[model samples]
Target: MSGCYIHIPFCAQKCSYCDFHFSTNHSYQNEMVEALCTELKIRSESWKDEEFQTIYFGGGTPSVLTSGQLQKLIGQVKSGYRVSNQVEITLECNPDDCSTENLTTWKKLGVNRLSIGIQSFNDEQLKWMNRSHSAADGLNAVRNAKQTGFDELSLDLMYGLPNMTAEEWKSQLLQVIALNPEHISAYCLTVEQRTALSKWVKEGKLTVSSNEQQSEQFELLVSTLKEAGYEQYEISNFARNEHYSKHNTAYWQGVKYLGIGPSAHGYNGKERYWNQANNKAYMTALKQGNLPETIEILSSFDRFNETLMIGLRTKWGVSKLQLFEDISPDKEWFKIVKDYEDQQLLIETPESIVLTEAGRLLADGIAAELFIIN
Candidate 1:
């Protein structure tokens, strides 16, 4: 099924580890909102006949917007697109921004899921990450959201931080389990270039955890979450009672979706497009009745590589028959697959091929090894 994503590119402050396209200067909020609606209207024609099964409000921080602004944007989408009655609408919120009143208002506005950014349960870690909220704020936010009847709650957790011990990581996971969220997205902290974290590491002011430590933490995460009755649906995502993130699931499944707002990316079956990351440029282009996006036509090889790359990381692995037919017709590819299976890195059933737990640790490398180079 198809989905829609709206990127809200406004944050009160930048985090040390964040490299997403967002601005601290929110002076252009009203202009950005209007521009977003205008862009939505212009792009709605393409997906007019298709019904959207999910809508996601991801961002710099979607919680920064007021209820009125949220209502206006949601209304614009509703009027323009054929959204399903049972559509799963999710909003990414920060701990400090969540309140009982706000949660209730969001529920009233048709937001069924809340993905809270509670990166850590330790105040010290929060400060190190430059998060706006404290540990207490995070706990309170989850309590408030739960009290407001949000059964579909997701929490973001980070591990592999510098100087973070295994005990600390376990404590964080235990605290999250105690909160009883429907979904948990645990990510290993990577130092991307141009981020403050990268700068600090470069200056020897901060030391990232060793790869061995990171791998150990990842194993702990999987084992602990599995014991807590959460299914590891994806490499980084754990869900209870099959309450996976539909929007993200659709994305990994290669479903076509429309991405609205600055710096958003959209994918149809054959082509992909990304909006300009600059806020001023995005607004200016929309105001001038032009769509500010760059489009790329995907070759068959591109699609095949993407399918293999994404599919191997999920619980539902790539279909063996389909992969053999669509991606590689040569016996050499089959030989490579057989070798991985022999090494116990890949599990091959009659229908599909999936990575074993050991293989998942080297998933990217394996996917690259299996890539068809011309």
Candidate 2:
């Protein structure tokens, strides 16, 4: 099913490692909300007939918005789109943003799931990440979300930090497990270029974790979560009782979704669309009743590579029949697949191809090797 994503480009404070589009300034929030609704309306003209089962509020910090701002945005979606009765609406929030009052308001606003950006429960790491919340705030957010009737909870964590230890990672995972969230997403910390993280690394002030350490932590994460009854449904996500993130799952499976607000992206089966990364430019164009976006048409070559890139990172894997239908694999490509299967890194079925546990650690490298370079 199709989905709609709203990017809130406002954050209280910038995380040290974040490279996503956002502004710390709140002077234009009202204007931003209006612009977002406008874009939603403009894009809905062609997609209004499609039934949407997921609506995700992602961003700089969706929790930064007030009840009125949120009401306006969700109201716009309800007015313009064909949302299904079983639609799952998720809001990305920071721990400090959660309160009984705020949680109640969010629930009334049609937000059924809360993807809280806990990041870590360690106070020092929280400060290091420039996170606005304390460890206590993270704990309170989860307790508060459950108390407010948000059963579909997803908490985010970061592992493989610079100088992180195996014991430390295990402690963090246990903290999350104790919280008993319906879904948990753990990400390996990467120093993306142009962020404070990269600057520190370049100056030799910080040492990023070695690939070997990260792999060890990843394996630990998989086994620990599995013992706790959570399924590693996707590479970075774990869910209990099959409660996967509908929007993300659909996105990975190549479902079409309309993205609202600056720096958001939209994709259909054949093409990809991304909005202006500049907030002012995005809002200005929307005010002028235009879409500030670039669209790329996908070729068979492009589609085939993309299928393997994303499809191999999941539990369901990619359909072998569908992959061949997209483009014929060359002799070399087949041999690479054979080598991986022989090593038990890949499992090739007549119908599909999936990564084994050992294969997941090398997921990116393997997928890259299988990529049809232009």
Q: Write the per-residue lDDT of candidate 2 for residues 58-90, one digit (tens) a residue.
A: 999999999999999999998999999989999
Tens-digit lDDT track for model 1 on 32-112?
999999999999988887889999999999999989999999999999999999999999999999988899999999999
Q: In model 1, how large is the Cα lDDT of residue 51?
A: 87
* Lowest summed lDDT window (length 10), candidate 2: 320-329
Q: Which stretches of candidate 1 lie over 4 Å from their true place?
A: 321-326
What's the CA RMSD for each of the models? 1.1, 1.1
Q: Which ranges of candidate 2 are over 4 A from the true structure? A: none
Q: What is the lDDT of residue 27 in candidate 1?
A: 91
